[model samples]
Target: MKRIPRETMVFLLCSTFYRLASGALLVSLTWNILNQESISYFPLALAILCSFIPAFVTPTLIRRLTRKFNGRQMSARFLLGLAILTLVAGACRYDTSALLVTNLFVWLLFLLLEASLDMWFTQVQRGLAPAQVQRLSGATTASSQAALMIGPLLAAGLTPLLGNLGFSMMLTAIFLVVAAICHSAGQPPITSNDTGSDTKAQELPLALFIPMLLVWPTLGAFNFMLPVNVMVQGWSLLELGILDASFGLGMALIGVLVIAGVSGSRLLAFLSGLLTLSAAAASAWLLLPQDLLFRCACLGLLGMAFGGARIQIRAAIAQRLDEAAVGRSVSRANALGTPVLLVVLLIQLGAIATAWALPFLMVMLSIALLMRLALQRSQPHSAAPDATPYS
Candidate 1:
């Protein structure tokens, strides 16, 4: 393995810590909301929809923000703000309206921080060779997945001692503070060339966006269903956390082994679609009669599939677009897919088990098949002899 750069190492460390905290908070928040007597699926779904509002505009927002503030400064500020918001949310956890409002802001801050980190990653990739970019991207993704795997375990251990709100507040503050320190200490100088030249922008292939459109909703629906399943099954919060951790482990393993090794666009897309379909199937199975071990297996499979698909889709997009266009292309994909998520959330809110699960599974499978066809059709036209490898 090549020696990782100091800046990259710092960035990855901070990102990993942030991801851990975010993952824990996600589980804790869902558990808390579901456990509440007054809370119902509608409000929770609405909150989720509101949370994704930032993703719809992330590309435009990041573009303008990066012009005024460098990635490090922006990320640091967002982290600090997020820390403050998290504390406030924890303090007001008993108030449903307050929690909902606070969580929305939390997601907004989180997305902004994500945008800054992604922008920095893109800029950093611009300074590396293609092979290095692939290795670094895989390593960074794997590290984040590792954090995600650990996060739920931490949440499970801490929730008993500190309570859900207290755990969330403490974890967010600690991790965000460390992340802020890392960002402040290792702030990279942004050169004028960090943004791409003003040459005519290349058209991003439609096939590149297909996976994002299909996979995100599948993942989102799985997340929505998991907490509900836990609630219906009368499982403990710790079990929920563990299940989430299992999913994270699956993602981490795939990131390290599969996505890191694969390179061809068609192959990546095919794998991404296949994994997504598998995740959806697993999610549907989770709603069926099964032993504890079987359920756990399904959760693990879901995680692995979701993780593998996510990395491949990202790799596919990166392989096709210039570094500068990556942000916009991804943001546009998210924007287009946002409504799909809203619909999925609404379906979940209805709490119709078979209706939602069956349709979701069918749709996921259909999309996966379509994406495979799309990739196959586009490969002949798009693949270049000297094209960058996606591995």
Candidate 2:
């Protein structure tokens, strides 16, 4: 794969700043709250739903927004807004009732920022040759995961020292300052209509998009509740940090494997789906009263399956859609799946109320994930032929 330009690297680093802020907040606030069991299924579900709902409209919104502001400017505006909202949320984190309301707004702000980032990065990747997509995606994925790994590690040490509210305040300040710096370093706008075609071109119908969107919910379900369950099961913060780190490690490791031999073609998608089933199976077994080493192995394996599938899925999308449309497509998928993930996670928590249900839910999520892969394979490739390996 060809290397993306140096300008693109700067762009990606700025984009990753938002995630770093999010990771800090999540580790400080969300993880601590889950440890206390103060955040139940209902509130968590509502929060996730609110967070992802914007995905549905983000694509269309970004399409128009990018046309007005260049990718860099749009991202700067998003970061500025996000930084402000995060500060406000941090200020109100102590007020239980008010915090919930603020959290809702925070979720909305993040959704907007994330959707915009997705769009911005998609544009960057689309501009690259087909061979470059895989490398660029891998690099971005590695950068994001690196932030994730660092976020929790920071939280594990800092949270216990500063306490939740104090750490949250710190996080808020960090995000606000970093975002400002990134905004100031924004790049010039690029030409938007690379295709040179006007609105007269026929657009792909939403019906064709729904199946792809469905994959989000399956992933959302895992993201929403996995950490909470691990915390609930009496795992130490350090242990949880390690587990989260393992997830990142698995993703990075699998990305390397893909560069070596994994095909992003249709055949690979089918195999990825079948492999996901094994991940679920391992997760289920771990949930069922297992040794620590065994559980760790399962979690790592689950992350591996996700790593392989995620790269393939993105590549598939990049192949099918235009460069400008890639971000919107990803945002749309994330938006559509948000509610489904929230609802399923809620149900899983309810089951947990009766007993330790992590193992069973792992089994269930595995089934759903596998089904998604199969569905992806059965669906015809809708993307126009492109040389980009990362969608």
| TM-score for all models, in order of appearance | 0.83, 0.76
For candidate 2, list the clashing residue pairs, or say none. Answer: 130-387, 130-388, 314-391, 315-391, 318-391, 320-383
Please, what are the lDDT tens digits per residue for candidate 1 over residues 209-237? Answer: 56666554665676677766676667787
lDDT of 2 by residue, 1-391 (tens): 4555766777667756666667666555555334334645555555555556666677677767756765556667766666666666556665555555655556555656655555556666765655466656655665666677677777788877887666777776777666665567645465565454742232333433443555556545555556665656767777777766666666666666555545444444534553664556454654656455555566666666655555555544554555456555666666766666666666766675432333334333443443454454445474332221222
Stretches off by above 4 angstroms in model 1 are: 127-131, 185-188, 191-200, 213-216, 259-288, 319-324, 355-391
Q: Each model's C-alpha lDDT?
A: 0.64, 0.58
How accurate locally is residue 324 in candidate 1, as Cα lDDT from 0 to 100? 40
Off by over 4 Å in 2: 1-4, 32-40, 56-60, 177-181, 184-190, 193-212, 259-288, 353-391
Q: Candidate 2 has what TM-score?
A: 0.76
**How many angstroms is residue 218 displaced in model 2 relative to the true structure, after the best TM-score fit?**
3.4
The best candidate in terms of lDDT: 1
Name the 10 consecutive residues with the lowest summed lDDT in model 2: 382-391
> Local error of candidate 2 at 297, Å?
2.3
Question: Model 1: clashing residue pairs?
Answer: none
